[model samples]
Target: MAGYRPAVLVGRWGEEAQLQEERVRDFMRRRERGELLIQKIKSLQESLLQKTELSVCKDGCVHFGDTVLLLNPAPAEPGPGACGSLALAVPLEDSSAYSAAPLRAPCGVSAVQGVDPVGRNTFHVLSVDGTAVDEPIRFGQKFGLGTTGGFSAQMFYLASDHKSFLRFATKSHLQQVFLTEERSYLTCWKAAFWDPQLRLEHEGFPVPANSKIIITHCHTNRSLAVPRNFWTRSYFGKEYEVVCHTYLDSHKAEEDKNCWEIVTGDPSNRDGSMCDRPDPQPGGVRKELCEEA
Candidate 1:
């Protein structure tokens, strides 16, 4: 009643019945509008929650705006001690698992588990929306690429949770790569699709959907990697160890630990059908995924 103003009747003083009718008509109109607004909101929620198609991935092409899954192509390198392949995922906060470091391992360590690709592995690939560039991610692009004092012209992704972002930290002797509910400059990264065997450089420039690639932290220069030999147990069971470190002297095959295959879409959808190796364009077939440190 404080801010509410009753409808003013424009007619005569003895028109009490007419005034009552006008008030009822006004109330009905307000109720009708409110119901219409609610219906529109419900329709929108249904569309987003049960999407039929991803706007950026209709053709399964790796577009900038697509949400994706980063999967290690598995023992991309086969050593006697390799753990084969695994998908990187964040642990649930309420789950009963913590990083059990070696007896001498440092304190305050954070651990992320490598398991099969699932809902916990979803990420949104994003670039500046109002930029001059288009969305399809391309090869030969720099990842975690920036000068010490330069502005970051990089790409990054967010966890499906919306509030979280992937972060690379060197706050300790070990390079700590963890998922933070907060996003910052360190959340930035880039994609590389240069497979030595498949020929990285002729014109396979635009990264096709489902291609094996390397994602590097924008500020750390370390690729997201999983070590099959470094195993651990979680509430879910035995899982591989995931980290972000670039081996300075790694050989061609040894570097496969850094290789990840991007499967497009929300993890809830469980769709990786877009993953297919791009036919290396017919020209310069470079058989290396990295450069010398």
Candidate 2:
């Protein structure tokens, strides 16, 4: 757990905004009128957790241009339901929030402030040449999350001013990973399979389809990971933070926190049991799942 400290170690960045009295009045008016509604989704289930999955991929190895889910099962976050495990997602779903929900405008993602957390968001795979072919993406090769004519639903992708790419920057020992509006060298990421049992890295092989895999930022050479304690309050409530820092304590280059299963084809249903709490009794999480973090 040496490298798994909760704090990001990176400085928080954002732009300034004016919180006008009118905006406060508007929020108060909305709160008084019962218009500030909170949305909730059913928590984590072993079978594909998403309801609106796009049919871009088939039941085989993950391919370039396939729309996929980055299903993360680490942290074992405590939430009502379905939100138990984390999934890589952006802050606001769309730009309509800034105009429609004026009180949130000052927090920064749109104009200057921002956030990246775990939620149910889909990403597309692409090679550097802009090819979204039916070919399987292999390990140790250059690929990226966002591409031309590919599906992207994150707030950054949906907005007009920002670029849609997952990028990282290393400041001192901390690697600050984030979504950027730039499509430069920093957006490149390569997948390396981690053996489930042995927790070892596999290179130069075809990445398995709909299986456990870890993505590394090409520029920082850090694995995409979720912090156990770091989090932020979002429109979707409290969500854990997403980072790209390789843990020294991880088994060989594969840590449970860094593991993300690819959601290729139909992620609609499963046995309908939550992974963390199978039994409905108090303190009923299975032994293996409740292992100390």
Candidate 3:
């Protein structure tokens, strides 16, 4: 209204308009780049989820992708490439009925049952006589006798009660009996705890279904052997020195049979009465039996 605007003022207003436009364009470009980066992050997350989905096992174990969560941490801390106390995860669907159920026992005895990762029961100790024996079979504890017969046979006798010195007559095949040491018969036996197939065979013949294998611990004291006088009263009448000759020259092929013999004692009484047998010499078999044999 005052005639006309000054040239300098007009020029300044034009410059301000151009600066605003440039700012708008720069903001738009930055927003576009930001949107593209967000889309790429979303796409990567979707791809990783598809490859490894988290799941839970029935035994209350968690499986995150391909890695199993460790329930019990190992004694030594887990380092790189080391699976800390990670055990084989047993799926809930594969759990056996025996393992899933709580262990039940009569009065005065407590039975604790736990299932292994493979869903096998770790506490069931099967007796050959079919009677349930709740006593835990310790790793290094002395077990019953392992005998062999001449016709290529092996038998296990459970050391159970006082009524009979050798309690049960449960017999298992030699092949089923796992001797930890082939050279020393006194070594601990390796019992099969878990075999998914549940078949232990020698020469195509499977072991008996009722056979209860014995588990052995290698680190335990080697002195945990069956006492020499274990079957003295049962086999003879009184206590007599008995020696276990696991290997013999005449019966080399039959290690199980004739493995035991009276070192010094007389079983002359048929009525289970103790006879006055001569004492064992420093290093000699029974004097009377030596002459006869």
Candidate 4:
């Protein structure tokens, strides 16, 4: 993990404020444009489906642009239902044919703080426990939880001060209750990271096209590289680290390690094995592994 340095607002207070405002306006303009491109891409996808005479199921199908199809077997399917896989559809003669159009803000919708133009939702900074968290959600700034917990949970508010940061509650610190005010930044090493790249193939959204973003917190001072391990808790409360070799062969393990490194800055163990590391904190015993890292 590497530290993120925020852009400083230089000059006198008034001048700095004006500069910040301009930066925010520019960001909103770009975001609006991105949203419009996404919309056009979605429309193109629907057109492709219609032309191919293939109807996307309300469930169990994933669409990407206008040429990809990921299928997940329904539970009622014969044999193992979990063995869904990816398949390509409608290859284009020119890849550039699927290029998305530039986006424009919807008519009558002003770029306002705290509102998502595409989703039509108000921005709110929320705590892990669902309470409204207050902080200046400024553009190019990072906000972190100020606690003594081992997990790193922070959010970077990109391009706008009005959009709310949403924090999905996690059962990371089950032993203690986090005070609303004690939320600070976090820095940690040795965590599990799961990439469900194909899990959401069959889903529908209110918005024709959607994007999901995940945020990770790291130290603002130092960069750390650590190996990740998977762990499981037994019925008697003991925890055991899961070695990848036990389940995946050498070739798959190496491929997975490479992909994991690409997705997460952390590298897999040199031995190509997943193992547990001893905790330095007093009385801190490994109880469970995080599903998402």
Highest lDDT against the true fold, candidate: 2
Q: Write the per-residue lDDT of candidate 3 for residues 152-253, one digit (tens) a residue.
A: 132222111111333221121111112111223233322222221332432122111212222232223211111122222211122212121222235323
Give the CA lDDT, 0 to 100, for residue 271 in model 4.
Answer: 17
Point out the higher-scoring one by TM-score: 2 or 3.
2
Each prediction's RMSD over C-alphas, in Å, is: 16.1, 17.4, 28.3, 27.0
Instruction: Write down the TM-score of every candidate.
Output: 0.51, 0.55, 0.17, 0.16
As for model 1, its CA RMSD to the true structure in angstroms is 16.1
lDDT tens per residue, model 1, 111-179: 233432333444555553232334566664432211111101222223111112343333323355554
Name the top TM-score candidate: 2
- What residue runs in model 1 are displaced by over 4 Å at the alpha carbon? 1-60, 76-82, 93-117, 129-134, 140-173, 196-204, 248-254, 265-293
**Tens digits of per-residue lDDT for model 2, 90-201:** 4343322323332121111211011111123555676675655777887777776641111133222211121224322222223555555556676788777665453345
Model 3 residue 263 CA deviation in Å:
64
Model 1, residue 101: what's the lDDT?
Answer: 15
Give the per-residue Cα lDDT of candidate 2 at 90.
43
Task: Estimate, for each residue in 62-141, the C-alpha lDDT of model 4 and write its tens digit.
Answer: 12111111111122232432322111111122111235521111101111111111111111122332323332222123
Better of 1 and 3 by lDDT: 1
Q: Identify the superior model by lDDT, candidate 2 or candidate 3.
A: 2
TM-score of structure candidate 2? 0.55
- Give lDDT per model, in order: 0.47, 0.50, 0.24, 0.23
Give the range where candidate 2 is weakest over 10 consecutive residues by summed lDDT.
108-117
